[model samples]
Target: MNNGTPHNTTGTMSANVSYYNENFVANSKFAIVKYSDRFFLQACMAFEGVSQYIDFWIPANIPGDGSIIELSLAANGGNLASYSRFPDGVALRARSGRLLMKYDWQTKRMEGNFSFEIQNGSTIVQISDGTFDLTGIVDGVSNSSIYGVGTFTAYSDQLGSFEAQEVSIELKDRSHVGLPNYWQIIGRMEKPEFPHPQRSHIALQVVEHVETKIHTLGNNPDAWASYFQEPDVGIIPAVNGTLEFTTLPNTGHTEGRLDADFRTAENVLIHVSGIFDIKQAKR
Candidate 1:
């Protein structure tokens, strides 16, 4: 993404915060070429960050080997550097209209609507509420701009469709302040394939296997505790029996959908893919 748009990067703090909020319009295009029976996809993402906007273009032409992509920041080799939450650098093997998005540190009350496409020529449009936390390690201990994850739920009528869109990282009211506002995940879906009627009986099993405690000291050192345990005895495990799940019949892969929601210690709510695996137990 290239933009004649200008950026503003002016800050003074102990930890350097790379600013990417400069307003600029980046135009990107994609072209898929078919040379043989296989199809190769090429995509480019351009956006303004810090001093200047950079371009990330990737081309994948090898059959069965998968595609490759990269992100380039600061075209003129400026002093500023941009960072992505995604540890894998640029998203690889992404289909058209597929994106891995996250909010910047400076953004607050992040809310937006976006669309995601699936392999079956279908799309999922989602609107979500952003999540946040006040644990800014780089901005010193007194910064108000919190960074964390958020929960999301959207409705769609399309069957057998699963996709994630409209993501953000933002702060919320004080009601969510310091309440162990940890992660909670729940999922429900339909079952598409059932070879054996009785054999196909399935249910989701949720485990609260982990927990972390945070104690903030006033302009002092931080303390915490961590542990792993099973689901609470009184509470029934969060599970949706007979939800639609993906299947691979050729290699003996079968199961139902497994939806998950998790809140990190940093107040980030991550929606992990809940794919179930069901089969006979070993003798």
Candidate 2:
């Protein structure tokens, strides 16, 4: 049984599936089905030159809208399974794995990053850096029609380089009593890390009639960035850095670059530099 559109529209699913030390940029299809009392979210993908496909099933009752769901066989009323086809046309079921899924109810889209292991007798297939995005689950109309593509990458000496699996950028124009009237750019990057996920943030303010080629970290009050690692390592503020905007903030979109250096409480050096292209959210 299906309430709304059961299958996804064409070109609505984007996914990358990796296993056996090989990566596949697959064409995917997704569906929302109701069986008995539970609603299931299912997806299947097919790659080029291979008879292999990966499938996943999850309960739709789990909380969404920027909430994280850790998938397990006993999760709610549904389980996560992956079927991979081999060269000899033999299919193997994933034995154990970890999956983290995030979704937005208003946008009708889902984002997932997962890694799992499949063992068959003496052979083990390792799946790593697997990611997928499924959109237009309700009416078969893409959410990207209303929202633009946003992506960013952050690199540091301590944490290496990581691309944000999900990115959000917001623009604010406000005037405080004591502070100057300015336009603020706020950005967040969500990185997929098993067990504990990490987030990086960028904040910059541009006051009216402030002319500067580069903004320094300590010298500037309106520019700053931070890294957040919960519990073990708290928020690490930038010690020294520079921020430059290639494309100034506007009502439509903003493009910029940031190079920041941070030092954790334990004296670990983190030199972060990356570029961002984000669309302004509708107000």
Candidate 3:
């Protein structure tokens, strides 16, 4: 797979905090190229030993002559905005805001001003006089991955037990300022020529963890497992499962085990279990 590169540019960001009734200035400001067409902008501000930050995404096709963009939580309306006041461990989504953007064609830079209100339940936080001046804006792809060697074995009620011929893991970090860092681990186990009818391929996603922990699947949005079979069975999703990481990715290695129960459309329950020890490969 072709992994992308992350672009970080220097900038300055500042705002007025309503909760503390103080002017906030960020010590670190940057924009990450999240994709070829999108950028993740962030500003980290610290006040009284507590860290707070504001972030949002912007499209690659921003207007150069200063256009006002609406920031909201609407599904189809505007760009999303997020506010994090740390040690609090909760991120608030903006209910309403505005972003004014100006792109410099000559210097390949971006300048913007914004103000937003984010609310968690009944408590609302207001941010005002927000401004940022970023330089060296370059468009690029955002994520990098390192492949790992591993073994995966599983058993199903409908197809019995099988071992994957090829097992690989991909680690993608999606951390932003003011939020706890987490890695999105993608594990793939495949045996294309396996004799079993529905035991050819399996994929798992483990999201939101930086250390070894037990992750619950099925109704959990952060973790899940899936499998695919040819011809008739499309993709089956796990209804319940548990993924336990004994050792997380560090120093070029990781170890984990998984047990997942997948329910097919035909009402068949498939159980899968596997253990994996992966060594990261040199890129």
Candidate 4:
């Protein structure tokens, strides 16, 4: 989405950390256009003085034959967002980057990893080990399912994606005796306190799946629910169609897909499948 304005596209991007607390999740809309005599992959998220984005207009192009294209911090790129109104913030105004990207025409998907820097004033934010994926791509969608910053998609017909407008990602405990599940990703539309905004309002949680730890949470996928606070829509208690988790086995990460065919109040249903890549945030 451009400036919180929905665009039909997909872009999931995030950084490790920003010195000034940047909070702009790169939405799913990476377009390769010819600007002047070169081709640049224009994928960025900047708005209202909050920016945590990846905009690279390089000499490289995405291969349609399922090959890898490298993009990295080998180059350049901003912001002001405190620990309050935003969950994340940018510390630089101009910067460069390096990355490895790929696009599979057969699958209509794009995947890549990167490391870059954004220098604002005398401060510089060094973001490392960043990655993203784009699916259900079109001319580009802004309001579609943007899990974190990437335009997300439903793995199944029953599942769907959403934008929390305001969300919070907390590394709570899934207390399981000794193996207390370390990741209980709590993403809500509720604006958090000073130090509790979702990934500092910068990194939108990825749409990958975080395997469900039954011992920690529960096995009842139908009862698994999620809802919007303001819109007054929530998951229907007994209306879940499919609920499953594909865990990362021994890692502090997991992937999940759930489709609740019902809601708490209205006939609203909540469907979403994605990854909670909170392992890095906890570090």
TM-score of each model, in listed order: 0.15, 0.41, 0.52, 0.34
Q: What lDDT does the true structure give each of the candidates?
A: 0.21, 0.53, 0.59, 0.37
Candidate 4 C-alpha error for residue 183, in Å = 43
TM-score of candidate 1 to 2 decimals: 0.15
What stretches of model 4 exceed 4 Å from their correct place? Answer: 1-7, 21-24, 27-52, 60-62, 76-96, 106-108, 135-283
Better of 1 and 2 by lDDT: 2
- Candidate 1 lDDT over residue span 1-283, tens digit each: 2311111111111111122222222222222222222221222223222111121221122222222222221212111111111111111111222222222324311111112111111222111121111111121122333222222232223112332221122211212112212121222222234541110111221112122122121111111111111110101111111223343211223333434332222222233333334332122
Clashes of each: 13, 0, 0, 65
What candidate 2 gets wrong by more than 4 Å, as runs, is 1-149, 191-195, 208-213
Top candidate on lDDT is: 3
Candidate 4 CA-lDDT value: 0.37
lDDT of 2 at 169: 50
Regions of candidate 1 where Cα sits further than 4 Å from its true position: 1-180, 193-283
User: Which residue runs of candidate 3 sit more than 4 Å off their true CA positions?
Assistant: 1-8, 20-22, 32-34, 46-49, 65-76, 143-244, 250-281
Ranking by TM-score: 3, 2, 4, 1
Candidate 2 has a TM-score of 0.41
